[model samples]
Target: MLRDLAGAEWPRRAGLAALAAALGAENIRWVGGAVRDGLLGVAAHDVDCATTLRPEDVIAACKRAGLRTAPTGIEHGTVTVILKDGPVEVTTLRRDVATDGRRATIAFASDWSEDAARRDFTINALYAHPETLAIADYFGGLDDLREGRVRFIGDARQRIAEDHLRILRYYRFQTRFGAALDEAAETACADLAHTLKGLSRERIAAELLALLALPDPHPTIARMRERGVLGVILPEACPAQVAALARLIAAESAQGFAPDPIRRLAALLPPSPDVAETVAARLRLSKAQRTRLVNAAERTAHDSANAKALAYRLTPPLAIDRLLLEGADARGLDRWAVPQFPLKGGAIVARGVTAGPSVARLLQAVEARWVGEGFPQGERIEALLAEELAKRPQP
Candidate 1:
């Protein structure tokens, strides 16, 4: 499975050469998500190296090789080796000393299996040789990967007890790569969903964003709802809106729309500004994210006479978001083609109108007439503007 990954890239080689020379080649191996992604033919974003050497040993090797090093997590036996492209994280093998469902105290260990066992899931426990790419799987992650199963490393309850964040991670991995969750894992997550409140808002928000970004997350969301996890994370979550999300996904697919987490979140929430505001505040969303969600909800509520009116009143993104939420296609967004009002303040001034509120009022009146008349162009627009101004009582 790792044959294609054997020919290490320069970054991989550089990291390995620096470390293998200082700590024996037998002590270092590529570990964590990189191994799993490599076997799945997914481009590993960050290359992580695990070693039997202590954190200081890893740092010394990086310094001896003339590479920059940082103690990113030295207390947990991890160091960052800065390479040309990016820093690769290297962690010494460690066994858990204690866990409190949020953090784990660790003690460095020489046994690779102990480190592997301490991990959360079987697939994430797999390791690879930095030079030869030989897989070291002590947990049958290879079989799970082949079968598209997401299983915990050992006891599901024990893994969840180590870190409640894993509850979200389990669903995320299932949505991203795996087909389904093991029954025991599902039961454990459902029973422990309440613990998610103990997690930081940032962590919970990040996981939710990842889950919502999946190509099609309606089923995953439904599963989350069934497991009681969704309500725990988002008290205002509307599982009933999964149907709306399905329409959104279909519309996006047909029209080549990029997956948008904020927009999808709007669809998942009750289409009310109050609900949007509450979710935004609960998730601690950025100002921009909050504004977009709220605007989409507000804009989608108005009964636009047509797509043109909708686009002209709001923005294309807002209109499209609203359309999808209503189970309607955003077909004309790319071709919104809403011509300008064809009347500006200067034009109103040229009409012998004062530059005060009257000028603004007259211009707005003419623009409304033009829009009401279906955005007539050229001479007709000029004629219509003249008629509207003449009908206004002299001031």
Candidate 2:
């Protein structure tokens, strides 16, 4: 049995206290990730609360308390209360009325245990009171949390049948917190891996990126492959690419770079821009994300000799991606800011070159020479320009 939330700082926020006072502190308790992470001693980023009060009543209470509230998910029994510090989600305790693996129809309930029962995982169903800071573990969530286990509540397959996204969530949680995979949950996820096809590509992409964003996702990713879940959503990422991902991770660590999900995703795919664009389209990635993915997929030698020139051509980030993918040193660009081309087309025209297509052609030639010569400036740029112009026929 978990005791009070001692080291948790979220319960002491003024906005939470004010809202609690307005809605009778006993009527509300911090629930879900906030409660789970608090007990784990991790700083909770978002605070979620469950209340006996209905959505409308919660909105009314917030308005009366002078706190702004938004109907973020009113149909599903949630209201966003904007506090001074940040927004805290306040939701009425709910029970699943119906579920179709994609979404659920929920009904308001006053029983905390009933609400906890409807949740997906035991660790996520834990709650903590506001006033006394007492934890309510309707399931063995406290024991599971202490054991670093992520088990689904009740029937694993049935819970997954309620929401197919849980399959990915299980892997993410397992990667983040679990010491060992729950055998039943793993089996259920493997069996229901095909159901992930029914989920929206956007949702699947979000979950996949979140999983890839973890510091060390190699083990979980291998487990996902073993369970046949990775192939369902990301068929482009072949088994051989798992080794590529491991190499990329090692390179990132060596370069003191943070874990980049998009770059990692690029590493998992073949070095073909066409394949990258196709996968990006299938996953519904944003335009910028798609471009980055394609850029990283381009088959190019990221030689250390031309590191600056590469950064100059394709921005530093893209250049770094290619360098890291090829296992080349990219630290030369750590503090180096790409310099602007010292001469423009106007400068070429000023040198008595015609202002038509010839001027543009001459500028390109000079810039190429400048880039090849390591972006020389001052007299060197003037010398390059004079040399290029001397080659051109006098007007």
Candidate 3:
């Protein structure tokens, strides 16, 4: 299946330009999702090339072309060629020599069929020649991709057993393709769900985050729960809460916020202390994102007495918190964060004629005085500051 690149023209140019220089007589072919997506008439961005060249040869070729090449995964026969516009990942054909489920020892091979067979799923095994506009489907991946079926390439159990992380990936693929999985594939995943303990929390978190970040997460998680995957990964997600969160998420999915990772994660959190931190640590999220997400969850769980306390509880997302309060029977966002502290630390320092802790105390006194006065004019603040400043020691 070939057509002139029309809509997303830049990425098409990037792929073509990179392949033109790198694939120059090397017989390298575009492989994996890039090809599958192209075949499905979907615009693809991350273009990967399967090459006949060995890792060393790819390195040498890039050097010969004066291209910057990094050993992205040298042991796994992958090198990222840094081109002027786009980076193309050139990976030699490889098949697993032995797999311990967590890691595998692979050997580079020239047999495209052998390499394709060792891949995880049928749809991911398809390859295409960008220049000639030809496709190579050794395992009937074309048919499977077209049918929206996510089936393992050869043996389902054997494939997943090669890497336990694939167990989570199956549901992610289900979310993307919405493909009806084969019976044998479902059985294989269900059987291996218990073996997920062998996988590291870091790996589990990555796959789970990707699944939750999908446009529609409920179907994917529901599949995982049904297939016994979620129990092993996230049992704290109350079944009813999970469904409600998903429903709220889908309804709010259209607007109100960017697709920020922390926002998405806040929507997923259960009413439990340390769970957010544990999951965030497990996923290896950046310190900022983790803290923000934890704060969001904690704020959502709180029953603050007043507007100020509630506003303090929810640092940001004033609008979203308002909606959440309505949904959760809490004080409205306005009533919660209604009052404003007009005095600044600098103003307090200036008024007190002293720095350090005294400035803080003076500001606090000013705030209290302002609130006590029910928020008066500049005359009231000036009068209050004058009274508080007299109590501070002159510096």
Best by lDDT: 2
Candidate 3 off by > 4 Å: 1-11, 14-19, 259-261, 264-268, 300-314, 317-342, 345-362, 365-395
Reference-based lDDT, each prediction:
0.81, 0.89, 0.70
lDDT of 2 at 43: 84
Predicted candidate 2: what Cα RMSD to the true structure?
1.9
lDDT of 1 by residue, 96-177 (tens): 9999998999998999999999998898998887666788899999888888889999899989999999999999888777
Question: Per-residue alpha-carbon lDDT of model 3 for 198-315, expressed as tens digits?
Answer: 9888788778778767777776666677777778877766566567556556445543333344555555667444887887776687887676657655554334334344454354
TM per model?
0.89, 0.96, 0.80
lDDT of 3 at 216: 70
Residue pairs with colliding backbones in model 3 are 307-336
Q: Give the TM-score of candidate 1.
A: 0.89
- TM-score order of candidates, best first? 2, 1, 3
As a whole number from 0 to 100, the lDDT of residue 215 in candidate 1 is: 89
Model 1: number of backbone collisions: 0
Clashing residue pairs in all predictions, respectively, total 0, 0, 1
Q: Which ten residues in a row have the lowest lDDT in candidate 1?
A: 2-11
